[model samples]
Each structure stands twice: as structure tokens, then as C-alpha cells.
Target: MRTSLQFIFLLVYASVAACCQGQEVTISPDVVYGHKSGLAMTCDVFTPEQDANGAAVLFMVSGGWFSNWSPPEQTQHMFKPLTDKGFTVFAVRHGSSPKFSIAEAVDDVRRSVRFIRGNADRFEVDPDRIGVFGMSAGGHLSLMLGTASDEGNAESKDPVEHISDRVNAVVAYVAPTDLRVMAKDAPDRLPAYDRFPALEIDAKSATADSPIIFVTADDAPTLLLAGAKDDLVPISYSRNIEAAFEKAGVTSELIEFENAGHGFGGEDAKKATEAMVNWFVTHLDK
Candidate 1:
């Protein structure tokens, strides 16, 4: 005989296991996209069980420049909203901080896009209809993909490098737009950033890494979701970038949650998720 709480726990666990065992989506875990220092850079692919819309979304698995891996099944809930809409999702993990700098992480993710694009047919997705979504440091990387992506080098020896990295749409939550400002002010004003060695970049590197610095007329349509009360990343970052996008005649929108902090909750989180799905569906049309 087991206690009610224990019985309920078992039921929940069983349900989760069933979900990952190929009920709702087909998950291909630990797919290596690139390598650094001999370690493989990887991403987990989640394809809907039915009615896949032929579009793809890449979710950056980053926080404070640190990328961590978790069991792919555990992340299904985070991607359910998109997957349910028949969108294939990629959980892209970049080279992490302390071991890898922000620049390296950017390169890793860019290579991921190239790899995915090069093998789009294998995944049953449109090579040109990819979108990106992330939050916090992940959000910053998402913006980087949206603003700084480029056509591939035709002369590159690696075949993956011959495919473009450009994304069609982007949704970033609580992202830092300007690394230059962060490098100059974050050390003193936001000492919390000091623990992440990736933010220790020099002015030139900061300028090169900042997403706002790379925005152009050809950039992807971007949707920025920010918390008005976010202390970790100010809302002004989103506002400024939105203004820049407007000036450049790029399609961009900013939505701020007044009562939220660095992360959203309850209705704010729900609203943000809906906005992201809608953005991708609109911009990544087949």
C-alpha cells in the first residue's frame, strides 16, 4: 500500500514517460551540429506527431552565456505550444561560458543554423522558413541570429558552411541588445554579471557582439518581449532596438509586462508564448 501523494507522483511520472516514448512528438536527441576543442556541439530535434507545418523554430538553450543540457523529454513541455502547432523545434546548445567565450557561443549557434539548413530536407522542414526563440542570455543570442546572420561562404571547405544562417523570424524575451553598454556598465551597476566570464569582453569585441550594432534593413522580423520591472535586463534595451528597427524600416514589435520581473509568470508567460507562436506563423509562412 502506498500513500496518496506517492501514488500520484508515480502516475505523473508514468504519464511523462509515455509522452516521451513517441506519443505526441518524435524526438531525436543529442544530434551533433558542430565541434569545438574536440567536444561536439549538439541540438535536440522535436517533430510534431501529426500535421507538421513544414516550418522550424530554433530555441537557444542558453543562460548567462552558459549552455546546459537536459533530458530531451523534460523539455517537451516548454516546446509543446509550438510543436502542437505543427512546428518542428530545435533545442540548440552552444559552447558554454568559462570554457567558451560569448563570441565562440555565437559561432557555434551560427554553425547550427548552417547545419540545420544544409540538412533541412532530412528534418522535413523548409530551409528558408526557420525562426528563433529564446529568453535572457538565450534571448540575446536569438537577436544575434536575427540581426547578424549571413549568406554562406561559397568557397568554404565544409559543406554546412555553404548554407546560409539567416532566420526568417525572431522572438526574444528579456534580452540585452547592446553588449557594449553591458561591458561598460554591467560590471559596476550589475555585479551579478561578473560571475559570467563571457561578459568580460573588450570594447571592440563588445561592439562586434552586440545585436543592436548589427541590425540592418534585411534583418528578420523581430518580436521582443520584456518585463518592465526586469532588473537583470532593462526594458529600455528592447525599446531602443525596436526604435532602431523602425528607423531601418524593419518589422518589429515590443511588448512589455509591467508587473513582471526578469522572468514572466502566469498570464504574462501565457501571453508571451502566444505572441511568439503567432509571430513565427506569420513570418515563417511556407
Candidate 2:
């Protein structure tokens, strides 16, 4: 058993180190996806071989909406399943909040997706076969992208900005779909939120931008995963989103992991990862 586990580990490690097997892996780290106030917004791109499946996954690495000047490398291992399965991944890091408001972070993520889609040929991915996945605050951004995609002005000089930001699919792990509802769900958190500048807004303002308000039949297929015990965001957020999706007649699902919290662990995480891969495969091909 130990040997089998070791072998699996080695296989994944080799793939992560050298890119997945169809063609040579081309890793372009810190590729600037956008420019914000003289600052460059970059994403780590992992491209597969030419004979690849031609699908792409945009993975967001955000927590607490706090912008990080440096994009983290921790995402590579977590996304190997998608890469190995022939999906290119763009590990997108948004302008963190507090230092940079969540609104800016939302813009950065949308711009990154446009950048990826704009350069789909260069990135060896299909422009229309894109998916976005994120956890926590990252999940919030992911949801916003799905609910709020738009095509840029075709007359714009910037080619990247001129492209559409719509994705084929979206997967949000433990995301807060409605902050207004979340605030009401847990009034005790008000004190903590009071310390923060941007999050201290009234419920109406928060609800105005929540993903639940944006549900439409035209929205992309989405999968919302939540742990039953997640006190931070709560499963109710996902449940409410799931209900909205159904009301809108959009393809959507909610998966609640038992004995899990804000993040999944051990087998739960593995299953969630597998579900993400399956979702992309199921939707991207169609």
C-alpha cells in the first residue's frame, strides 16, 4: 500500500514538474494579465502540449479579500488534476482587498479571464471552453464573473479588453454567494466586520452586488461546494444560490460535505477535486 501511494505521488510530481504529457509543458509565470494604476496584474500560466484537450481553467487564489503583491506557488499542486487531465490552468491572483478593495479584485479577475481568452490561441486553449474555480473570497470573485460577464467595447484599441469575458463553467468552493444574507445569518460577525473598511457597508449595498441577485437562465453551468460545518461562509450561502439557479432554470448543483468546515480535508478534498474535473469535462465538451 505504501509503495502504491508513493508511486502515485511520484507520477503526479513528475507531471507537475514537467507539465502534463501530450506535448511539452510551457509554464509562463508572472505573465501580466492586466495593468492597474501602473501596477501589473499577473497570472501563472500552465500550458499543455499542442494535442491537448484545448480547455482552460482559471484558478483564483484569494483569501479574506486582502491583495497580495506576490502570487503564490501553492496552487500548482492543487491544480495538477486539471492539468493532468488536459486542462490548462491560469492561476489568477487578484488585487487583494483592504489594501485594494474587493471591487478592484473583481475587476482584476474579470480582466485576467479576458486576457486568457484574448490570448487563447497563444495559450493553447479554446476561447469558449474556459472554466473558473476559486475558494473563499476567491469563490466570491468566481461567482461574480459568472453572474456578471460582459463583452468589452469592440472599438477599444486594447485587443485583450475587446474580447468577451464569459466562461463555459464555474466551480466555487465554500464561497459566500450573498454577504447580506451571510451578515444576517450570523449577527455575531458584525463586530469583526466593523473593523474592516469596505465590508462595513449596509445590507442593501452588499445585496446589490451579491451573486444571488444576478442569477439568470443565460448564466454558465455552475457547481457550488460547501462544507456543512463552515461557519465562516456557511452552507446557506450555497443553498440559496442553488435555489436561485433552479429558479432561473440554469444548470447548477450544490454539494455539501459532511464533517467538513470552511475547507475540505483528506478524502473530502479529493472528492471535491474530482467533482471539479468531472464538471469541466461534462460541460466544456458540450
Candidate 3:
């Protein structure tokens, strides 16, 4: 009986230790209604317990611009490790394409950030320390939210409308930088690409929307992770963005894994998580 009790205690202790080992970031999903109409949009907020004005990360999930698929578990888990390290994290959901236009989806993501920043007091997040994170389609959304800042509708009376959507840092994994161009380059996607409207990105708009195009001395710090073998988003896209950051004298780094492809899992995913944590620690620590 003594041995059995000891074993049970050990198991419980181990469980509690694991839970308390790193920073305990809690994730909660909340709904943010659209302006004028109460159309509901959901965003997940990951907050650190006992937080003292720590930085925050607004995470977006990947879904190929389709609302039919609900938010993935991976999206919330990716930000957990970060919260363990002391950052409040937010996993935001936006309107997807087809059901909603891409522009409207972009607006959704932008407002999600604003909502978080606007409620910093309730979340115990340092509004200035907020950053952005995303993978694949979410990666594309993160880039757009971080780079394109001119589209916010300042006339709205919504409480979320008054918050600034700008982010201090960015961590993107396999994010599509040049969407229209990438679609043109992809053979498999080309046949199925009838969903979106004509690719009408003019040079100015493309330059404005592309994260790579927005890299400048004034740009926020960024970290990019990509798979070298990813046929979906060529490694060159990351390279181009890095090059632009370099040209503009911005701080940025790109990590490419030779064996990984598309989405990472297991060890590769672990490495990606560590890289993300380090990036945020370096930038948000201040």
C-alpha cells in the first residue's frame, strides 16, 4: 500500500511539475462582432498567468482561405510554448475567402489585433510588446497585417476600432509572400484557382501588400521559418523577403530545414518552436 501510494504521488507530482515547468499561458476563444452588423468573428487569446506587462503574440491559423474548416488545434498549440516563456498570445480567426472576400478577411485579422491591444488591461499584455505569428495561410495573413497599415477604417464606432493594429515583431512559417505570383507559379493550384477573383494586384498595391515589399529600415523585426524542400512555397520567397530586409537595414533572420516540407511536425516542429521562442525573447524581452 505504501509503494502504491508513493507511485500515485509521483504521478501527480510529475503532472503538476510539467504544468508548472514553463510559463503557463492560458488560451481562451472570444467573439468580436463586426462593425455596423453584429456578424460574429472569433479570436483565441493565449495569456500568461501572473503576467506583469509581458509581451503578446497574435497568432493566425492556416486554412487556405476557406471558412468551412474550423480553427486547427495546431494553431493554439504553437503559441503555448511562447506563453510558457512569458508572453501573452492571441490566436485570431478571420473571415475566409469565398464566403467572404480576401479584403474583408484581412480586415478581420487587423481588427483582432486591435481588439487585443484595446483590451490590454484585461489581458495583462503590454500593448507595445505585441507581435504576430502564423503558418501557411495564417502566415500570409500575419505578413499582411504587419506590413500593410493603411487600410484600417478609422470611422467605425466599435470599441475594437480604436485600437491600433500595428505589430512590433513578426514570426512567419511558410507564409505566402506574393500570393498572385505564387498562384501563377503553382501548377496544381492553377487548375483549382478559380475560386479567387482575377489577380488584380497592381505594382503599387503588390508592393504595399507584400511583406517583402514592405521591408525597410523602419520595418519591425521579423523572423521567417521555411522548409527548403517545400514545393508549395519555394524557399526563394523567404530569401527574397530576407534580401529586402537586408537592403532596408532591418533586423531579420530566415531558417531553412533541408528535410522538412510544407508543415512541420515532431522534431522539425520542435526546432521551429524554439526558433520562434528565441525570436520573441530577443525582441520582446526589451
C-alpha TM-score for every candidate: 0.90, 0.85, 0.78
Q: Give me the candidate number with maximum TM-score.
A: 1
Candidate 3 local accuracy as lDDT? 0.65
Q: By TM-score, is 1 or 2 better? A: 1
Q: After superposition, how far is residue 208 of candidate 2 from its true place, in Å?
A: 4.2
Which regions of candidate 1 fall more than 4 Å away from where they truly are?
Answer: 1-23, 184-189
Summing lDDT over every window of 10 consecutive residues in candidate 1, give the lowest-scoring window: 1-10
Worst 10 residues of 3 by lDDT: 1-10
| Clashing pairs for predicted structure model 3, backbone only | 23-84
Each candidate's number of clashing pairs is: 0, 5, 1
Highest-scoring model, lDDT: 1
Q: Spell out the clash pairs found in candidate 1.
A: none
Which scores higher on TM-score, 2 or 3?
Answer: 2
